[model samples]
Target: MTYYWFAQSVGVLAFMVGITMFFNRSDRRFKQQLSAYSAIIGVHFLMMGAAPAGMSALLNSLRTLISLRTRNHWIMVIFIVLTLVLGLSRAHHWVELLPVGATVVSTWALFRTSGLTTRCIMWCSTCCWVFHNIWLGSIGGSLIEGSFLIMNGFNIIRFRRLQLRGIDPFEVEKKIVKKMEENQAAE
Candidate 1:
């Protein structure tokens, strides 16, 4: 097989992992898994000679890791600056900017926001990635992003339904806290 085919096949595997993780209910778990698998996707982008996409994915991994550790906006600002610098440095075509814009949206969503806002921003990012994938001829990658968008929309609808019933869709995190309290009481 050709090199592009091999590299895209690997990218497809990473895309599947990343998409699965993206759907995780736990925010921390989702970010951790996304960071890990996205590194592989970045390498795949590099192998495919899509430098802008590769850099964006790498920076996205870094952003996820940092956001996981803390919610400090300063750190996020620094990363945004870095992303802008790097993106502008190598960006020759307008299409190359697509991944960079997606990264920016994702960084803000993961770091500076929460609740429905985060989910909304993620959907926007998914749209950008879909465009990027199509530009790069990554059929699997585009489909993965499309799937992510649909799943996110479904989850949002489910959350809205829970709200209509006076339930917080985010109660899972609270459940975790409650379980910890129960364990403490037992001890």
Candidate 2:
């Protein structure tokens, strides 16, 4: 029963994101932001498809593993080993880390974005992830995503305001200048 409701909410959020992305398609700045946020939501889709309830437990275990200074590949190898061994042995502990791995991969990718536009969508991504995870009854580590989501929302809203108020454009040469530069360098 709970799973159904949770899935429904996630579906709605996904829909919201999709609609926003579509309407935003003509806007390049928003597209970049959407790309960044989409990465995070994409991870949520992975988690919701995987272990929706175990997100926190999985992330906690990941945090511990990451804290141990283990190399990423080795850590992944060990994780796989545990999954095959301990997991098959009925040790449920390591099996739950799947969602955490998804979250980490998603969040890490989102962190690579720059610019105010991207900074804004970053929050939406985290919120979308946490919103689903929270419904699954795990609050742990979600705040990290949620906090960034709020900050990003604020930044995005500010941008909308600036744009509406006719913000000044940063000057940069277009194709004509670039072509001249190329011709000069050729000479």
Candidate 3:
């Protein structure tokens, strides 16, 4: 097999794990798991010589991990700025901006939103990633992004149903916040 096929094979495995963790819809663990797997995906992209996708994935992995710890938007803002600056530093075609766009949207969704809102924004980001993957000739990446789009759509619909039934699909976040407050007060 060619080098491209070999790199993409491993990339696909990482993408599967990352995407699966993404849709868990449970708690911060989702992002944490995604962060780990995404680093591997980044390496895969690097092996394929897709610098734009590789850097974006690596940055996104960092973004998810940082977002999990703090709600501060400064980190995301810095990340976005770095994305624009460093991302453009290399001689790249405009098509390379696809990953940057997806990362920006995903940063906002993961850091600034919750529940249904997060899922909605993530769907949009996933669409961008799908296009990026296709453009990069990553067959596995495209397939995983397509599956993520479908799965995220289902989740949004499910969350909406829960909302209609008077349930907060993001109750976990609220609980976490409450617990944090309690801990801070005790301290």
Which order, best to worst by lDDT?
A: 1, 3, 2
Residues 59-114, model 2: lDDT tens digits: 33443334223224445445444434432333244434444444444333323332
Query: In lDDT terms, how accurate is model 1?
Result: 0.78
Which is better, 1 or 2, measured by lDDT?
1
**TM-score rank order:** 3, 1, 2
Off by over 4 Å in 3: 178-187
Candidate 1 stretches greater than 4 Å from native: 172-187
Between prediction 1 and prediction 2, the one with superior TM-score is 1
Which candidate has the highest lDDT of all? 1
lDDT, model 3, position 129? 80
Q: In model 2, which regions exceed 4 Å deviation?
A: 1-113, 166-187
Question: Residue 144: error of model 1 in Å?
Answer: 1.4
Q: How close is candidate 2 to the true structure, as a TM-score?
A: 0.30
Instruction: Give the TM-score of each candidate.
Output: 0.86, 0.30, 0.88
lDDT of each: 0.78, 0.42, 0.77
**Residue 98 CA displacement from its true place in model 1, Å:** 1.4
Residue 68 Cα positional deviation in candidate 2, in Å, after optimal superposition:
23
Displacement of residue 22 (Cα, Å) in model 3 is 4.3
